[model samples]
Target chain A: MATSAKSTDISKTDFGKSPINARLSAEQKLKLLTDMVRIRCFENESVRQYSAGKMGGFLHVYNGQEAIATGCASLMGDDDHMITAYRNHGHALGVGMNMNECMAELFGKATGCSKGKGGSMHFFAPDKNYWGGHGIVGGQTPLGLGLAYALKYKGVKGAAMCFMGDGAVNQGCLYESLNMASLFNLPVIYIIENNGYSMGTSLERSSAFKSCLAERAAGFNMEWAQCAGTDIYEVRASVQVAMERAHNESRPTMLEIDTYRYYGHSTADAKHNVVGGYREREEIDFYKKNHDPINVFKAKLIAEGVLTEEQFDTLEEGIKAEAAQSAVFADESPYPEVSSITEDVYYEVDRQTEAGRTGKHFFND
Target chain B: MALIEYRDALNQAFDEELARDENVVLMGEEVAQYDGAYKVTKGLWKKWGDKRVMDTPISEAAFIGMGIGASMLGIRPVMELMFWSFATVAWDQIINNAAQVRYMSGGLINCPIVIRGPANGGTNVGATHSHTHENFLANVPGLKVVCPATAYDAKGLMKTAIRDNDPVMFMENTLLYGEKWEVPEEEYLIPLGKADVKREGTDITLIAHGRAALTALRAAEILAAEHNISAEVIDLRSIRPLDEEAILASVRKTHRAVLIEENKPFCGVGAQISSILMEKCFDDLDAPVLRISSIDAPAIYSPELERKQLPRPLDIVAKVLSIC
Candidate 1:
């Protein structure tokens, strides 16, 4: 069942020497590493709890592609926004959402980010400009276009970061979004996290393209760039350029970040029957050895004398403990009351307006 | 009070709401510069300019989805669809994204956007162009559907829909766009989910919404004059937050009931009304609840046949007579 993973040397530049990395304070650089570690620790714990039957529905863990979300979110201004598909735990954590609330959401407790209504796939934090963890494939593309449209409407010099997987590139709505993003000159970046395989379909099988996925951006006459997601510095540099275009010129950009996922598309693909049958273990090991985002960044930080080995271990341990405590918080939190089931369907009902008082809004009620 | 065309009433509502709320914006194909395909958005573009009143590409899914995204951040986007039949292309945005955003986010977000356009038949636009999806939209628990039969209700209901915190699917009729009725110059808001009794009667209850409500009113007059049957006509302006109380109150007094709608017979709005009557007003009913709807088929393309396809005044009269 082993399908050979192709070895493509994407980017081998030493980010320790890059100006973008040098510009960032040592504390800020450590914060980025700490954020990536926090996400990984949380995702690993989610998979553990999910396997142990603590979570329901599909659990789409963002294990390996942590640097893309971490890098892109760092460049976001207060007016900027972020939205992503169901593989959203990484982005939600990167945007500084409470780990306990996010974990409680996965556990379907009242304290969850979405109040147990939107399990893992619908995290939302509008106060922090994290729009959602939308469920549908390619559906979030247009919604992302909208976030940018609204920003422009309000005359904010900010952009919206809309992240999707490689497989989502083929959806018709993405093309529709691309056309409008260019026509209106909205400040939105469409980041495609190309992880070699989508669910079970490899990039070679799922998409038809001339050279790369971002090349399709040429059809709309928008700017595009490709980068390796293993190095956070490279991710920041490539995304900073897109952010500048969005802020200064009010233009959209398509970014293709080459990454890999160690887990299956979701926890349900456990047998690896879907993914393992398509991709080999050697391929997975190759990425883990050569291009693990956390390891790659940690080594660069140490080589630059930003942190000692002891400091790195202590930081990782603290994040791991924080991720573990989130599970305990989720376990202790209560489920929503039965009477609360009918609430939140409408805003008027929640606000108890004059309109909400009269009608038989709920048929069962 | 001033008599205004249905289209003008909607225009006045848009103008007033746009002026009232700076957060409110209008976007859709041909909405700006072109003054709207149906002219429901006429003159707004010249007033609000590019930022507030804008035109979008012919892509329904993208624009509609964009409206939803904008609404989540407190932008009240009153999106026009040119024709409600075109909403099928953006069905995911309407049904899943718009309707379910607030509920799925557990009330963390509110999509207070109004998607307005024509949804009707009898103009011989064929099956594709002629679609009435009020029943489909109302079926979803999170969505609110309203169909205003009169110019007064069009303006009142539309203004309220724009202010409401949930997604509202405002269904309009091309055939009734030019029809004139009294709408006051003063600002007013018609609370949704409240039905208006177009006529009072003692024998039978006739219920309908949108353009079909007018048809039911005509049938009520026919039944009163010709057949000597007093039929109370109930116009259920809001479909989702249904006015079951009004329906029950009218049916209890009349002792017989007849539901009517422009949608197909199977699982139409009329079907829902009949079910409500059966469950809530069974003891008061003197006969089985009957329904008169557009013939159970796709909308006909032929002009002559299309008229026959939709429920006429005589059709409602016949159904009332059968039940009474």
Candidate 2:
């Protein structure tokens, strides 16, 4: 067996300086930059549409943590699976969900990814191997192990990435999943996005561990690492190494991405006067000033001669226009048919079988 | 046709399904190496090997949710609970994920998984050990709930539940695992949501499912021979997509109905049937729709209290006579 790497606290490791084993092609790098831009632009527009009453329910924006999702998405092969918690709009865009469909879903249109059924919290693109935008906290943790189990059972090579908040690290099912994933040698990468606060509770208050969120993973005999989530290259490089261990060694790894959430927990939390605030204005300014992922990446691109200052501005405008076009597409899409509400509640039963269906319920009669 | 134990029939179904499809997997506590706590999976582990018939730790929430996830990705998993009552621990996965995944995804994904185990409240087991959660699970929109009373129904429905495209909560009765019934060796399947008229009559409809249906059959014999009343026994094998037509036809014919179940009457499966009958056929009923169910309390551990707590043949007869 490969070295168990028993919780080698990589929280302070400089993964950005780690040798880039699988360098992205020029087109792929450009795609990653555009993907991050799209998520930022789209979510910023969501705030507008939400305030304008175009959307209802919770909208947890992934504004500052764009680099984490963009980096994780880079490691995912077309066949690899990605599952995440409700703050999943960024992950959806990162994993290549249709921009128009995703926006339409936010607008509750018939043409949405979930056919207007699942709003902001639930986005699914199984065709792209994006499992779902699970609403329940830690709801999709075991599912990551399950997908890996199936892949291993079928001798498939791809890994299943399960993303959740730092809050989800305390869930009992996640512990069970970690135990089983390690026991069975399943290819599952447990990614915990540690944005400090879980809902309104700070990390100190919720988690028993005084240190990093990934420290608890040691009990499950699972290899784990932590990275500064603001740097896309760091997240990409670190997760890529973890994914390689999962693929080549058929092992499970827990990655705690030290990140921050710009907005409140949900759209409701965004109203500062109503709910007050979890963090002070100065706390917000600290991350914004030092670790703006988009700007940081832009600076890196300029230094590397990938993008000039003027070109970056033009690219930003292009992304904003793309997001605006998606919003328009969503606006044009119709609401789901009235009868569509009852549909999809169950699988279409085989009518020919006497038992599968019962004369099509009360309405049809 | 061959006479076999209810557990063996379930085992046969598992063996056959595993043989037929490579994707079909059986998982639960002590289901593989230990041959199941009830020995329902006896010797199958040796036949199928570890990969096909596997054992899992006592983490129901994790394994059950894992089964749902695996099923979504082209694997057919039959997850067994040691007791159906233990499902409360993994309630989120069963109700939230298993029941809602198909609906929330706009049918983009389907969970073809079967969760099976005994759900009756007899055999001296206390409250937590025994639970008839048919009403609770069936109430969920996306799931299909099935109960098998006889050895024949057990084999047929267990096979069907395995092959079903949606999530199926296959609730078995602990008391009836050893019951013998003749099952055909030929390939056959009993479709879900279809009620079987175990015995036909015109005087009254004795509605029941699982082991209660078997007891109802015994009560029907007593009513026929001693009381001279021809009772139609309607076994509701499928609970969720209920056989309303079959029920209505029986109620229309009998003009009287008595729901017999070993579950609580407070919003139980019997209560649902009573309401359905009242709504659909108020005029057809010769008397008020009566329900003979377990007493409104936790299942008692004391043998005498437990027996008295659940509906017996006498209770069925008494309820039937009152309706008649």
Best by the TM-score measure: 1
DockQ in order: 0.79, 0.64
lDDT of 1 by residue, B1-324 (tens): 788999999999999998899989999999999999988888989988998899999999999999998888789999999889999999988888998888778888889999999999888989999999998999898899999999999999999999998899999999999999999877999989999999999999889999999999999999989999998999999997999999999989988988889999888988887888888888998999988888888898989899999999998888777767
lDDT (Cα, 0-100) at A283 in candidate 2: 63
What is the per-residue lDDT of model 2 for residues B215-234, given as tens digits with 9 covering 90 to 100?
89999999999999999999
> Global CA lDDT of candidate 1, please?
0.89
Every model: Cα RMSD to truth: 1.8, 3.6
Least accurate stretch of 10 residues (summed lDDT) in model 2 chain B?
B101-110
Considering only N, C-alpha and C atoms within 3 Å, which residue pairs clash in candidate 1? none
- Local accuracy of candidate 2 as per-residue lDDT tens digits, A107-150: 99999999999899889888888888999999899888888888
Docking class of 1: medium
**Candidate 2, what DockQ?**
0.64
Name the lDDT value of residue B133 in candidate 2: 93
Kindly report the interface RMSD of candidate 1, rounded to 1 decimal: 1.0
